[model samples]
Target: MNEIWIEKYRPRSLKDVVGQKDIVDRLQSYVTAKNLPHLMFAGPAGTGKTTSAIALARELYADSWKGNFNELNASDERGIDVVRGKIKEFARTAPIGGADFKIIFLDEADALTSDAQAALRRTMERYSRTCRFILSCNFSSRIIEPIQSRCAVFRFRPLRPEDIKKNLGQIAAAEMLSIEDDALDALVHVSQGDMRKAVNSLQVAASLGEKITVELVYHTTGMARPEEVKQLLEVALSGEFIAARNRLDDIMISYGLSGEDILKQIHRTVFELDIPDYEKVRLVDRTGEIEFRIVEGSNERIQLESLLAYLALVGENRADSAD
Candidate 1:
């Protein structure tokens, strides 16, 4: 807790988790039954998939949780060979107590290859008597159907704004950092439902000074302030191509944003612009095309520079047509 907040502040029990109430209630029922089938947790990053897995293990195993709880990240484990090897090792022994089975938590499980997942599915069947598996993944669609059918899938939603704010307030009180009301709101907005990001931002901002402000939050996260992004779009729409290009370069270079990151901001900011509705739609569609190219490994700086020029053209067209 002294060194890092995310790990230190991670929820230890089901009740401690902030959101996903229905899933928590279901998990609590599993605890009461003293039995669990395979579980698949599907959601975006920074939600409580991993946390719920650990909390369930703790609830089930009491004093001997660590020995019975085995955690493996499928993204790092790579191939079927490694997966089989680790499962064999963990499942070899009976659980330490009279409990019916041990638990293996495979995090980021959607990263596994088809072959690897097929092998893992077999492993799950073979060990059904003595072991249970809980898989956590960002997207459940990638998980094979055989594996899906075996598990009770739970979809985790991103934390609500109030949930994030409550956690931030507790951490600030505990850590004794001074964060303003608006600054806290900004943190929540930037996190986009990721509690891990919100907590990390607070910790990073705290490192710079005792008083954490909105400016510090934006600077520490390397995100262009919303207004800066809005202004960049405004400049481009006003037909100042060179200045807008320079500003875009500064934002990407100074803020460490990928082309995708900058374009996402542009897409959102477009809706807030004074431009006509049809033109707003056109810019957003163009942003999507460029973003796809960047994702396919195009040169980011060149693509973004060209995008500014396109905006300049759109502005001129808007002026020339003169509705």
Candidate 2:
């Protein structure tokens, strides 16, 4: 099996992890002190939490870091039994290189049950001297209070477009691939501040050995290209509601696009449509509201259909008023 690009290209040191400068700076202080707290890295996926933790372990422990670091996924083994047993086994040993403590990196800690978390809390206290725990989760709220209280929490933000572009440009030069300017921008836009997604898309495009284009990024992300989305908008503007709705359904099913993904495409496509500036702004504002509602457990298909119908009405109104 081919190794996944995300893992293969994961940042090896703190300097290589992009974005989150404040968190990195604070972490550097901890490394300098040779005294680290239990850490809770709360952030969205693909934003370098795990990578930073591993990097820290490697930096602090040097050659024998592997034996001193234990990494586990809480979601994969969801019970306290495995966690308790592993911690018991790993924490029993002293640091191989005479460091103060070994490191245990627990990923997806939010997946643990409350009972499991309680058990984990006791484990943290019991092994406090021998092992430092770095817990990572998408949401900090799901972690139990006692567990949360023990750690220094760091919130990681999504990478900005500039950061993503800089990293992608570096990778492109190293991989010997040429990307069109617009295509690079499209990749950054589609990735939405996730560097891992940006790199993976770049790697896939590079494998094809062609100058990366906007259409390629869209296909790689399984979203309709901006041009196709604009085409659908034009059909809506012409008051061909049935045709436009049909096209939306076809695209969703063909590409497996989520409701949120469609909304993002619509938001971008609106600016490209030939419409009054005021109308474009108004439509996008309404689209944002509909997207929020869909995310909050509203029926996705119905919410999206409502958005399309509203766009069609606006388009028809503009046409009639113009006439």
Candidate 3:
């Protein structure tokens, strides 16, 4: 019933993590040896990097995990002073409760500035005996090479749909909510393999009603229904320019969707169309260009209408060739 289902249902131990089996098995090996090298976890957001770090610390130190583990977000204090002050003070200190070494988790380590990273490398070297570092980032290339060389890098991949569904299903049962099959599919579509986003979407949908339906999920998430989006494309492809543009206006206003959002949905729908492969390729290419224009501050309405006009033209051209 808690509002934040993601954290509420966060796995306490690494074994409970939904995906990343190989990473979990390797981390368990370190736990068995009661030793760990400096580790770098490179992955996209919401892929259990923080959970793994917390779970590792707990498994390693048991009751004293809190005392022996220190977690800091580098994005909040990404400067040389933070590296020298808080990081150094923690690294140089001895572990409490007779533990061999303390663990310092630096989340978003890629956000640290070059000067701060240079300072951190020396600190890491100086405190090797008393401290081990776990650096988490979205991109490993942003981290300096020296730091990369010092740690064993583990890359986390996006969760598969089945894994995300399994996790969400578990949450649904625990919360005593009923979810339709189509609704689950919608969650998967919107989340794009992000468990946190899926769970959060479910939580928001649940608050709106007792039964989670496909409509509820899309409404809560501010995304147009897949069927509606596909229909829009179908109408445009039929060369009904005025009708399709009217439908586009309704979809955008009703869903409160931005131009980019609609474009992304259209892009996905393009591949699903029964049209020829060549046509799909051309549509995707044009979609990318429109996306770029929108990003550069062009009027969303004008660009979207232009796309509809193009689709109508494509339809017209196809009719001519078939004659």
Candidate 4:
């Protein structure tokens, strides 16, 4: 069976991990000292929180990494029971290879309930001698201050475009895939600094054919082409409300995109529009309102059409002022 490229190409060592240079350097220091405090990795998704935890364990434990490291997703069982049961059991165990302490990596730790986090904080305090905890969460604020104070916090930043491109380029060369330059750009744009998304999109595109094009990247990823999104906005900005609505319908149906997806694309395309900054700001503000309405269960089609109408109004006012 062909392995998932994300897993196949995951950075095995701190040196192999891309981006988060500061975090990686700090982790290396802990490994050099063979000592670790309870750690909290706070960051956005796919920014190497989990990967960094796993890599730290491997470096610290070497051949015994698997035996000493326990991985759990707090989101799966976010109640106090897990903290009292499985976690307590594992945390009290002695390291198998004479290591100072075992590591427990809790992913999505912010998902834990108040009671569970309270229990977890106590557990970390009690297990400091026998085990160390690495907690990963998208939002550190959701974690109780007590737990936050107990751990050395590392904040990870989103990957840069060049970093993502370099990693993808290496993966492509290794996989012997031929990808067009525009296809690579499409992947980067679609990924929005998420390495996992970028790699998975590339893998999906590669499966469809040997040579990946812009169309393949966008089609496989279920994203409308940027140019198409820009065209929709341009049509609306020219006061062609009906024409813009028709184009909007085409883009949504063609990509099977959700209302939020189309709205997000439109929002991104707005700043790039040739209109003045004030118009762009108004369009962006209106897009946010439409997005909020859609998220609140408003009818997507009506909400989207209303946005196009507003765009037409903005366009008309701009023309009148020019005259």
Candidate 5:
């Protein structure tokens, strides 16, 4: 529904799209002139590329925007037929309310195959005067060279931590939620520079009531509690191989901590440990190899156990060398 936080909080205009100043500036130029070129918006997920494209349409057409905009997802529709048919239907119709050209927004355009993209290139050229295409994708490299050449490419960067915090604060105030500074920081860290995720997390936390804490976000993201993960690492570093393996099994069973996630926590915890530089480097290298092997279809529990064994050895080695 339109009342959903993500949709409800969607930016209505260029200024509302956060953390993309340069892209906004270039897009503003097109809106000001009322004559936009074909555009390719490339960026990571939830970073406002689709939202910016919609905002641009809203600005350019004002009240008549709906009639002048056509939005489609290349990945959802599949193949070139749908794209060609939609482009023909939309481009054939003149801009509503006497506007010079209509706008077609293609989300996830990079999903189209090379052959489909070639067909899209022809359609783009044919409709250049009557319709402007705004293509959105996670990666620009996947788009065919010919289509990329025809469009003005705007790269959207992930929102910075400060930007995420600022926007989250605004949303929190609007929703009448009280939050602590540390909790907010935790949300930002988990979001990893994604404003949409931050907002969504805040909305979920707000829905539960006023007392939102960092642990709430940690649970929301399905990550094992930091304390629990820390405990597992500490036990492993104690050099009691059997006890360490038992603790790992308990963690995996109780909290569903996957091999990949355990590896990430181990990576983070390694830096915080009092180990020497060379030893830290060696541990990290081994951790990386285990991570890669886990990803490459090695049994998760087996690979992780092997990793824990290595950690135990390293901890014992370090303790002995220190002695």
Candidate 6:
């Protein structure tokens, strides 16, 4: 059995891809023409950006795709010199297999420095006849305007719940297990639309050799159960300071979640609470501040604990005011 479902089931052709149908259709047009222009794929991680780029190359070059396609992660290289060096080396030889231009798929292209992007723009122009560039990043805004204008840009959204559900269902059946209803719900909720994460969590649960259940999925994925998160809100909002603090600790320690991670989930959880919209906005504002502090190197535990305390007070004051 293949250990890594991600690689085992990665889409080989554009049609095999899960969602993002409009982007797939546009890419297929290029495949039919056998002519790909410089392209940019912008989206969150695990959304099939790199997969689409590779699949396009495979469809275009057939058996010789391996020789003609180059893959690079801009984050791995320390500087633009490395990018320039690699591009020079790859372009030294004409594309193999009678293809018009070789392809260099640069993953995390936004990580490249501004100076690097500038150099890259020139590089793309210099090698337009010999190579095409496919840049993928989470934020297209980070990429320079010149680079953005040069290529066909495709924006990828998070996979829909149905898309994730159908794919995971197929994978679960293939593994020959009876998936509990809650397992799929927990998996989708925890994954937050990252298909890679959803598939990976499913694989981890299957490795335990037991029926996949909600608790097991949460344990395997190191995620706090939605109910637990809800309860945390309940405890905090009800002004149970010690209990709320302890619950926060349990979630953080048990799940190995960072402060920012917990805070972001709390923000999501706040919206689900049966609180007034005004109270929800207040809690979200506090969460936003703490998240920033955690990211900016403020002490994680201290900051989050403070936020919980504030929520407790807010919940109390709001409850009393309603009376």
User: Which candidate tops lDDT?
Assistant: 3
Which wins on lDDT, candidate 1 or candidate 3?
3
**Backbone clashes in model 1, listed as residue pairs:** none
- Which lDDT tens digits does candidate 5 get at residues 219-286? 66656655666677677777887888888777676656688987787777777776578878987898
As for candidate 5, its clashing pairs are none
Score candidate 4 by lDDT: 0.93
Q: What order do you get sorting by lDDT, best first?
A: 3, 4, 1, 6, 2, 5
lDDT of 4 by residue, 94-130 (tens): 9998899999999999999999999999999998999
Worst 10 residues of 1 by lDDT: 83-92
Higher-scoring candidate on TM-score, 2 or 4: 4
Per-residue accuracy of model 6 over 1-323 as CA lDDT, tens digit each: 46799988888999988888999999999999988889999998888898899889889999999999999998887377966788767865699878888999999999999888888898898888898999999999999999999999999999998899999998888889778988999988988789999999999898887589988898888778877888998998898989999999899889888787777778788889998898888888888888888888999989988987898888789779989
- Global lDDT of each model? 0.90, 0.85, 0.94, 0.93, 0.84, 0.88
Q: Which residue runs does candidate 1 get wrong by more than 4 Å?
A: 253-258, 296-298
Badly placed stretches (over 4 Å) of model 3 are: none
Question: With candidate 6 superimposed using the best TM-score fit, by how many Å does residue 188's alpha carbon deviate from the native?
Answer: 1.0
Please give the lDDT score at residue 93 for candidate 5.
78
Runs in model 6 lying further than 4 Å from the true structure: 253-258, 296-299
Location of the lowest summed lDDT over 10 successive residues in candidate 6: 78-87
TM-score per model over all chains: 0.93, 0.83, 0.96, 0.98, 0.90, 0.93
Q: For candidate 5, give the lDDT.
A: 0.84
TM-score of 2: 0.83
lDDT for 79 (candidate 2) = 89
lDDT of 2 at 9: 69
Angstrom error at residue 287, model 5? 3.7
